[model samples]
Target: MPAHAPARPLEIAAAGPLRGTVRVPGDKSISHRSLMFGALAIGRTTVDGLLEGEDVLATAAAMRAMGARIDRGDDGRWTIDGVGVGGLMQPEQALDMGNSGTSTRLLMGLLASHRLTATFVGDASLSKRPMGRVIEPLSAMGAEFTASPGGRLPLTMRGLVPAVPIEYTLPVASAQVKSAILLAGLNTPGITTVIEPVPTRDHSERMLAGFGAELTVEPSPAGRVIRIRGEAELKPQSIVVPGDPSSAAFWLVAASIVPGSDVTVLNVGMNPTRSGIVTALRLMGADIEALAEREVGGEPVADLRVRHAPLSGIEVPPDLAPSMIDEYPVLFVAAAFASGRTIARGAEELRVKESDRIAAMAAALSAIGARVEEVEDGMIIDGTGGDPLAGGATITTHLDHRIAMSLSVAAQHCRAPVTLDDAAPVATSYPGFFSTLDALAGVALK
Candidate 1:
């Protein structure tokens, strides 16, 4: 949908016990990387369980624009015939990234050393996001960028053949930034190093190596040091993306708080860096158990079984911020129903996401009669001791999918129905969110 598409107002009321088993969509991070890496690999690559969300589709469209042959078969598997590393063709028009900051930033890195000039554009929300994090490192590697003011999107970037490689230390803990630097390094002639003060997701490193790139990771005094050698050849392989833990977060918190709710989410990705929500919820006394641990497409996988339980809020560790950064909104919703106050700090990164998640969640919670105090980095929430909240206000989602979905979960425990000004944003990452909620709750969310 276009950024200016009509607002999809949705209302949710308290439902009965939610009991069912379901599979969420594939991991958005992995889905994005699969298409990108597949596009740069030398042979045919097939992907199963690829997320068909708008954000992932944007990445697919961008890859197609750059001369990759991508098609979806009737069986739902996607096939990509790649042009190989350093073989990208210049896109004829500006790449419209929709709401996917991941696609925009990572593609910038991929294009950094390609000897081509491409333009990128996105929706209102994505255009507001700062792209300087990526532009800075790619620029340092000899790529030139003409971004909008404050280095936002709707920008043109010119890549350099024989790009200079440099060692860059991260100023913030961001997988997108780290991945951007590494993607740029793929087409450069020498080793490009990225020094991290804190570790984020390793999807890029893992997928890069899986696609036959020369990459190495080791411990350093600074943090984890990652080096990638450029001008490398890539070999395509079949990939099966696991269920997104981020998408499973809603049901995890929902089942924990709602009475008599017992739900199982299947095939959730359990990558250590991405499973902080489960750990944090368990810390708050959530009755969540991991069943059938296994490996899918080289990432840890498991089925999460969650049952209703009385939760007690605890001071969230600052170190866990990087791991569960995207899950904070739903975590805050979970905190609102716990037995005590939940304190979350060191998550200043939330301020720069699709929305200012801290502020957005704080306001939405307060409007629904939950006690919440907004802070510089995070929020402090006083729970209702598993009691239903007074939900009587219409929430402004600001076109953020997580916020919309989190509030929907909150509405399941509300005495009054909660209305969202725009539920369309949910399609960006989890298109079936409301329908799945319907299946579990056994009622139309309407």
Candidate 2:
């Protein structure tokens, strides 16, 4: 709710048993895509359960600047009137994307093939993150850009009309890069094909097809082949976003580490591409059960009932990295209280997040008395066998939301309160996190 990502310092201590059913914010990934697809579709598209987080709000603002009409009704549904493909107008001013990498990248893709030019800027954190991954490929498609050094933001982009289409293979496993190319393909002349060497989240592919875009997927020796026909028209859809599993992971890890805890997270997205946290936790000997498994809004859904159990660390499978990329901070926290050493490998992607998560967690966890060391790609953490950590240090959040919340969850087994310097970044993905943590801890945050 703050005008910017402020520093809201808070001290987190072990609360009485975490016991409750909580629905965290709607999926931030899905929320951003819903608004984007809605703004690309003709007529009216209504979205229910959209995350009102500042990240998603930044997306809404960008769409509005491009001449789309977006508003939320009293029923908590967001309605969008799109400008359709190739219909975007040049914005009057630079788009301030706040702390969302997802919004900035995806919107860049959407703007790449249109006949418009827009400048973009973000807060300190986002400005430091690399935009080269999105820029290099979009530049290949003839989109010209003037960026800060290393393709960082505070940049201006000139979209190419009737853009050239090319087949690009992903060098890394990133849903954002793939979606950007596919979104730019919307107005391209020929087919825009993306070859993904590693499968990441498939929300864009599934949602694009649902919205009447011509998209397809096939297995290839290299990896997977995805093709999108250009000049596509998107049909408006009524979308319901599922609860963010990334947010659910905090409670999952909290209940797993804190003794006498029982928590159930409801309506969480169980999409295979994004459920690596559940898998990695299970590998670490977590006592989690999937209850009431069902399908919702084209994605798998389940209620995860997590109870406190003694966990033993394992060598996290490298294949699980892409599925749970957003969850490593808390996964690191989960490892801190496990029985043995937990090694997370093949997760070089952590280096480029809102913060260098691996280094950040290594430094923070070590300072809080956990035996932690950073590797080039991942991290190694020696656990405390469920013992409370001797904590009395201020951990900096670095304008990263997950860093702020992961430490909060880590405080479950701390002897003293763990102070976070910037709890405000949590507003980007999970605004109700503290309140929900309060309710489970038997306190009223209000």
Candidate 3:
């Protein structure tokens, strides 16, 4: 399941109830930040439950290239000895960032003020994604970039030492853009501020504080104002990553859609900023119960017990989009099985993910005989009233891992088998996805 493996087609058929308790991989957001922040800290930082997926591995590789001594122990613990603030070494070669947009964008911020020049290259899919959102802010802080047309990848950037600090307001609610600015502030010489009109996931903010950076968040009339003082050293600490709720989202929706399915996903990160899927599903009458809710690694953790239930579609609130942006593709799958029409709006961000998720999901769903309409910002889906879909189409996943997995879950309630053009992309985030699905359904899907 390597990131650059040959195309592997997958076919999933309607299966019996998916019943079991499963623990997904580590939270991808936390896994990426843990490695980056650990690399920037002054001492040894140890991480447990690190996701060894291709995306997080890409981050680990990038940090190692920039002078972090990172190693994984036999006991599944990763230890990083950071070079401290202003101590990054210039990489000897271009950083190859596989298919991870998170690795590329966040590292752009991490390198913006390091007084080093780095060239970044990625796979074709990542190359097409817009880097301008991150580039615009980091460039404002004095980083010079020579990017592809439209600010795409295969870009060379020269970092600025003693980078200028600025209060940048988000033109969009993107955690990557916000995180890049904060990461750049770590090497800058003054107070760096970001104004987020709508809150996205706050993993960057929380993890920065955990690393002992002088960062603060205050409520603003516009939204949240986050300020980080630059040139501050980070302290290394032990971290235990929680299960990714984004990965857990697939099972939650699967159990809700497939009759007689009951599944419990363990130790899920329930950070309020990233729990919009849970909220939206609850509104749609999904039978999701939070069990053993508690704190883990300074974030809320819960074991989610979901039982099959008839769902009624409802208007997905626009404000919920930021928290659950990555989960929208699968949410559309859940919507397809609900009792009525589901309308999703204010999610234009979906258009720019690994694929145009809105259109991708629309086309894939429609091809399989689900009623879906592609909208500019989002999608409108008419459910089958819990009926199984006629799944005789081969879906093109467009090299998006979420798309591949989301459609796989949709196949659970399909009459025929649903075929994916490529499932290799699933290794980027959830390498164990198919195996886990097999275990839940008690059938081998190949």
Which portions of model 3 miss their true places by more than 4 Å? 1-4
Alpha-carbon local distance difference test for all models: 0.94, 0.91, 0.94
Question: Which regions of candidate 2 fall more than 4 Å away from where they truly are?
Answer: 1-6, 443-446
What 10-residue stretch in candidate 1 is worst by lDDT? 1-10
What is the lDDT, from 0 to 100, of the residue 327 in candidate 3? 94
lDDT of 3 by residue, 1-446 (tens): 12356889988887779999999999999999999999999999999999999989999999999899999999999999999988889999999898889999999999999999999998888888999999999999999999999999899999999899999999999999999999999999989999999999999999999999999999989889999999998999899999999999999999999999999999999999999999999999999999999998899999999999999989999999999999999999999999999999999998988888998999999989899988999999999999999997999999999999999999999999999999999999999999999999965477
> Listing every candidate in turn, what is its Cα RMSD in Å to the true structure after a full C-alpha superposition?
1.0, 1.7, 1.4
Give me the candidate number with maximum lDDT.
1
lDDT of 2 by residue, 1-446 (tens): 11454467887777668998998779989999999998989989999999999999999999999999999999999999998988888899889999989999999999999989999899888888999999999999999999999999888999998899999999989999999999999999889999999999999998999899999999999999999999999999999899999999999999999899999999999999999999999998999999999987798989999999999999999999999999999999999999999999999999999999989888889878899889999999999998989887889878899998898888878887888887888888888888899889863221
**TM-score of structure candidate 3:** 0.99
lDDT of 1: 0.94
Query: Over the stretch 1-446, how does candidate 1's per-residue lDDT look in tens digits?
Result: 13556898998887778899989999999999999999999889999999999999999999999999999999999999999999999999999999999999999999999989999999999989999989898999999999899999889999999899999999999999999999989989889999989999989999999999999999999999999999999999899999999999999999999999999999999999999999999999999999999998789999999999999989999999988999999999999999989999999999999999999999999999999999999999999999999998899999999999999999989999999999999999999999999999965466
On lDDT, who's better, 1 or 2? Answer: 1
TM-score of 2: 0.98
Off by over 4 Å in 1: 1-3
Candidate 3 yields a Cα-based lDDT of 0.94
Q: How far off is model 1, as Cα RMSD?
A: 1.0
